[model samples]
Target: MLIYLSIISIASILCLWSEKSYKKGELFLSGFSTFLSVMVLSVFSGLRNLSVGIDITTYGKNIFETVSTFGPSVAIDYYSRWADTGYVLFNYIVSFFTGNIHIFLGVSTFVVELSFLLFFKRYRAVLDPTLSFFIFNVVTLAYSFSILRQILSMAIIIWVYYLLTKGKYLSAILLAVGSVLIHKSAVFIILIIFTCYIITKFKEKINQRYLLLLMILFTLLSTIILTRYPETIDNLIDDLNISSIQLNNFGSPMRFILFLFPVLLIKILIKEKFIQNNEEYFLYLISLITMSFGWLGGINYSLTRLTYFIIPIYILFISKKLKIINKKSINLIIIFWFFFIFWWLIGRGSEGGVIPYIPFWKEYIVF
Candidate 1:
């Protein structure tokens, strides 16, 4: 835990320095700092032990060993029986090079972090990119150590959204399909993008408040319906061929509170006219809608993973809003929120099986 905190602190400092460089138009320094920070995180995550993540020791390791032993073709065919094509192909490619699972972990971490950094670069104009990077480190980066494949899918989704915003429709469509291949939960990205597009087109006809209210109502209705008709939900889950275990796992109150915080913050920002740009407003609204859906689907763990793809947008929107507030107020709010998220991860995030940190080198030491 101390090592994790140290890495985050160093990364945050570098990000702040990067911001200073950006302000001075020192492009090289700014880019270097950002790159160095990303490398710090990626290296730390990639070098961790196979036993570090709960899933890594069990499911992740098994997949790696299976692919390494059976050869890519057989492994791909076997995994295709259940897993998505992109993930299966990813495993095949990684395993083809070596039988060591650690190598795959390292490669995956590097790819995901690099992709995320690229996405951040593209959207730096929309927010205080440094602060956004810090927020991601504190809130989402550590969690990625546990859900590697999902995080990779999330990176692809971010790129897809960026492409859509730039009016690169064909590229966005291709990327969105790729994201779905990486993780089926990424299908929610399509819904989010489509909804945001509709909202943008009909901004004058629609009320943001009404849309939020509708989301809240939908959340309540879905929760009540699922709770009352478990059999129906089970049938739906079966038909979708999703994991049955997800039906038994519900989100905690803390998770709901974290999701709600952004909704409330966005509302306050909008009311104060802090968010005036249509595209920015649409992104925040989509974030809220996705989070609401996540909360509504809290009964199913797999469904909740859908929200992860949009969390970077939420973080960026909040970071943007904070920039317009009084410095002291922003400082206090950010400090409080950062610590709260840190506490949650150290405590409740044990479900990811990332607690009691252990380094990969430790396993090879004779001592």
Candidate 2:
């Protein structure tokens, strides 16, 4: 944990010392630096040595069997593998050379981080790289898991952004299709990217307020039909069974913050005349609406899965806003993040510990 603090302090200092170089439009350099930061964190996941047996799958093994057919790709349970087809391939290909698991895990982790650099370069001057590094390291990227396919699918999506940057729509489609092959979860995001593309033409026809209203109406209607329309809702939930799983503890508080922070940050970007890019602003607006869906009247707490949709846009939106934030504000945000990370990390440790301690902060209990 101390190492985490060390990295943050070093990265923040580097960010401050040469702020002008970044402002001079050092797109490749900044993107590469952010990617490097993520790569470093990925390489060290082993040192973290954390494990959770949440994901697992299985099938009939060699009970005098010869030459297994269909492999774990088909045999493994969906939840155990994060339902990622890519993860299955990663472990499968590596199994052929040597049954050692760590080799594939390590390679996959390294590749994920490396591809992020490519993604960053594509986003380029459109984002603030320093802030990108800060979030990747401080957030959940360091946590390694057995769910390799989901991880690899995420890596592929990173590269997809580059394809969009180059206007290689065909290549983007191919990559997203490939991601779906590796993990079906990518299917939903593929649809999102497509929807976002269609909405881009509306840059001339529609405005943000109009977009926000449509988003709100869509979300409310979706929630109502899902909640009030019993037969349809049951059919869909029964098929997906996703909500039945333990909700991702994005620290529910973190969920609220990730949702609201974009509105605040984007407001700053708008004030600075920085958000005119059509595609970028559309993504930002979508994120704001996705989170705001949490507030709709009839929606139960199932919108948790929507985070997967919101995060990338938030990253883009916040990164753009960071460039306009004064150094003092960035420093303050960083400080708060450090203390937040520290408090969160130690609390997690205590929860995982054999005997949870009663910390002394609650002094009034004694009083």
Q: Write the per-residue lDDT of candidate 1 for residues 42-155, one digit (tens) a residue.
A: 777767887776557534677677767775566556555244568767877887687677768777876776676666656666566666666676766666777766887888
Cα RMSD for predicted model 2: 7.8
Runs off by more than 4 Å, candidate 1 = 22-26, 68-70, 81-83, 95-99, 228-253, 262-270, 326-328, 363-367
Candidate 1 TM-score over all chains jointly = 0.83
Error of 1 at 193 (Å): 2.8
In terms of lDDT, the poorest run of 10 residues in model 1 is: 236-245
Name model 2 segments beyond 4 Å from true. Answer: 1-39, 47-50, 56-84, 96-98, 142-147, 225-254, 268-274, 289-306, 325-328, 334-367
**lDDT of model 2 at residue 320?**
58
Q: Each candidate's lDDT (Cα)?
A: 0.67, 0.49
Relative to the true structure, candidate 2 reaches a TM of 0.67
TM-score for every candidate vs. truth?
0.83, 0.67
Candidate with top lDDT is 1
Relative to the true structure, candidate 1 has a C-alpha RMSD (angstroms) of 4.1
